[model samples]
Target: MDISAEKLKQLRLERGLSQDLLAKQSGLSLRTIQRLEQAGGGSPESLLALSASLNVSPQALRHSSVPTISHWSFAQRSVQLSALLLLLALLLALVSLASHGQFSIYLDLVSLLFLLLFVPGVTLVAAGPMGLIMSIINLSLLWQHATGSLAERRFLQQLYQLQYRLCYGSALVLSLLGLVSVFYHSPHLSTASLQGALGVLCLGWLYAACAAELLLRPVLFKLNVSIQAEQHTLAN
Candidate 1:
C-alpha cells in the first residue's frame, strides 16, 4: 500500500476526523497515526486499517493530493464573533457575581432577554425548554412579589439571580462546544498543537471582548445620554 504524507493528511482532514479520534476508530496507536500522516510510510496493516477507518480505498488514500485551506466565510466569522461576545459577557457577569456576592436582578434579566432576543440566539433558542421552565418559575415569583411581602420579593430576587447564572452558564458552555467543534474540523492546525492553541484562543477572545467593552463603555454612555437629551428636546 503506497501512501504519501500529504495524501494521508488530506484524506484524514476530508473526513473531518481528528488524529486522536481516527486513531481510536482505527484501533491504531496515536503516535503511529501521527507518524504515518507526517512521514508518509506505514506498514500494510496500518494502511489497510487507516483506509477502512477513513472509508476510502487504500489506493485512493495513496493518490489524493493535499487539500488547500480556505478562508473563513462571513457567516463563519460572524458566528465566531457572536460566540466570543457571549463568552465575554458571561465571564464578566461571573466575575461580578464572585466579587460582589450579589448582582442586579434587573440587569441580569435585561441581559438574559438581550441574549434570548438578539446576539447569537441560537443557543438560547435551542434551550427553549429551559427558557419555558424559567418563565413559569418567574411568573410564580412575580405573583409572590406583587403581594407586597418583603420575604417573597427577596426570595424571588434570589431565584431570578440564580436563573441568570444558569442561563449564562448554559449559553457559555454551548458557545464553547461550538467553537471546539469548528476548531476540531479546521485543516490549518496540526493535531498535537490544536488543544493548546484552542485554549489560548479562548483566553484571547475573552480578553479582547472584555477590553473592547471597557474601552467603549464611556463612549456608549455619552451616546446614550445624548440620544436621551435629543429625545427630550423633541418632546418639548
Candidate 2:
C-alpha cells in the first residue's frame, strides 16, 4: 500500500483536522505528519495510524493524481500592460516636474496629499470588506510575483481581476465627486484652487481609465477562456 502525499493531505483535510490535531489523534509526532504530507513516504505503522485516525482505508490515500497547472491566458498581457503604463506615468510625472520647476514641487506635494486622503477612503466605501480582502490577497500575490514564485495561474487571474475592479470602482467614485464639486463650490473660492481641484480629479480619472483599458480589460477578456474550459470539461 503506497499512498501519495497529495492523497494523504486531501484525506486529512476531509476529516477537518489540522496537522497538529491529526498528529495528536494518530499518536504521531507533528513532524512525522508534516514529512509524510510533503514526501508521501511513511512506515506501515505510521500509515495505519493515519488511516485509523482519518477513518479511512489505507488504500484510499494511495495513488494520488498529478497536480495540473491552470493555463492563465491573461497573465503576460496584464504584466506587460501594467509595466508600460507605470513607465509612462513615471516619465510624464518627471517631465512635468522638470518643466514646472518649484511650482511642480508644490503641486506634487498637494496631489500626494489629496491621493493619500481620497483613494483609500473611496476604495473602502465602494468596495467594502470584499475589496479589503481582495487587496490583501493582491498584496500576497505581488509578494509572490516579486519572489518569482507566483505559479498559480488561477491566483494570478484573480489578482488581475480584483485589481481592475478596485481601480475602476475608485475612479468612478472620484470622478462623480469631482463633478459634484465643480457644480457646488462657492463663488468666493479662487480660480487657482478650483483649477487645482479639477486637475486632481482629472488625474485620478485618467489613471483609472488607463488602468481599466490597458491593464484590466485584457484580464477581463481572459475570463471567457476559463468559462469555456469549464464548459468543455462538462461537455466531455
Candidate 3:
C-alpha cells in the first residue's frame, strides 16, 4: 500500500503464499507478479490481484499514488532480446538441417514449404501473442518461400517498411544469389552457400533484435490526469 514492492511481497509471505500462488489467486501470470514485485513493467491487473488476494481495499493500493516514468529504460529489455536471438539461431539451424536433402524440384518445393511454415510457426510460438504484429510478416515471407510461392515483389515491399530493411535486403539478396548459385550449379546441400546466406540473415536478425530491444519497451505505471474548473463571477 505504500508503493513498495517489498511490502507487497512481505504481505504475500505472511499469508503463507508463494509468488506463483499469489499470482494465480490474483489472475496474473507469474512473470507479471515477478515484474510487479521487482518494481518493473506488469499488467494493471496486479493491483486488482493485490486487493483480492490480500483482502485489501483498492483505496489502500491507490493511497500511495502511482509512480510515473517519462521514458522506458533498457535495463530489462536486453534480457528478453537475448532470448529472441537464441530462438532465432536455433530455428535457423533446424531449418538448414530439415531442408538439407530436399533440394530437388519436388524436394525444394517441400523444403520451401516447410521453411515458410515452420520458421514462423516456431517464432510465433517463442514470441507468443505479443510478437504477432511486428514479426508476423517476416515469418510469413519465409513460410511462402518454403511453399514455393515465394514472391520477390512482396519481399521488396515488405523490406521497404522495416527499420533495418536495407540491412535485411542486403543480407537477403546475397543469400538468394548464393542459393541460386549453389542450387543450379551444384547438387548436394551447399554448405558454403548456406553459411553465407546464414551470415546475411544473421545480420538482419541482429538488426531486428536490437530494434525490438530498444523500441517500445514495456513500462507500465500511472498517468497524471488533472482537471481545472473555471469560475465565472458574472452578476451572481
lDDT by residue (tens digit), candidate 1, 1-236: 34677878888888899999999999999998888787665667887898899888887766454222133234334544565576687769878886786543213342344444442243235446564454345453211212323444344444444444444454466457657765767787677667644554344334333433432222223233333433342232
44-77, model 2: which lDDT tens digit per residue? 6787898899999877766654223256436645
Residue by residue across 1-236, what tens digits does model 3's lDDT show?
Answer: 22346667777787899988987888878886787677633334556667788897745544254343223224334434554576687567657766886322122232343334444454456445544344444334321221211243333333323323333444355457656765675665477866654444344344443333332111100000100000011111
- RMSD values for the candidates in order, in angstroms, are 27.2, 11.9, 19.5
Candidate 3 steric clashes: 6
TM-score for every candidate vs. truth? Answer: 0.26, 0.41, 0.27
Error of 1 at 81 (Å): 69
- True lDDT of residue 11, candidate 1: 82
TM-score of 2: 0.41
For candidate 2, what's the RMSD? 11.9
Residue 216 Cα positional deviation in candidate 2, in Å, after optimal superposition = 5.2
**Backbone Cα, N, C clashes tallied per candidate:** 0, 0, 6
Whole-model lDDT for model 3 versus the true structure? 0.45
Cα misplacement distance, residue 20 of candidate 3 (Å): 1.2
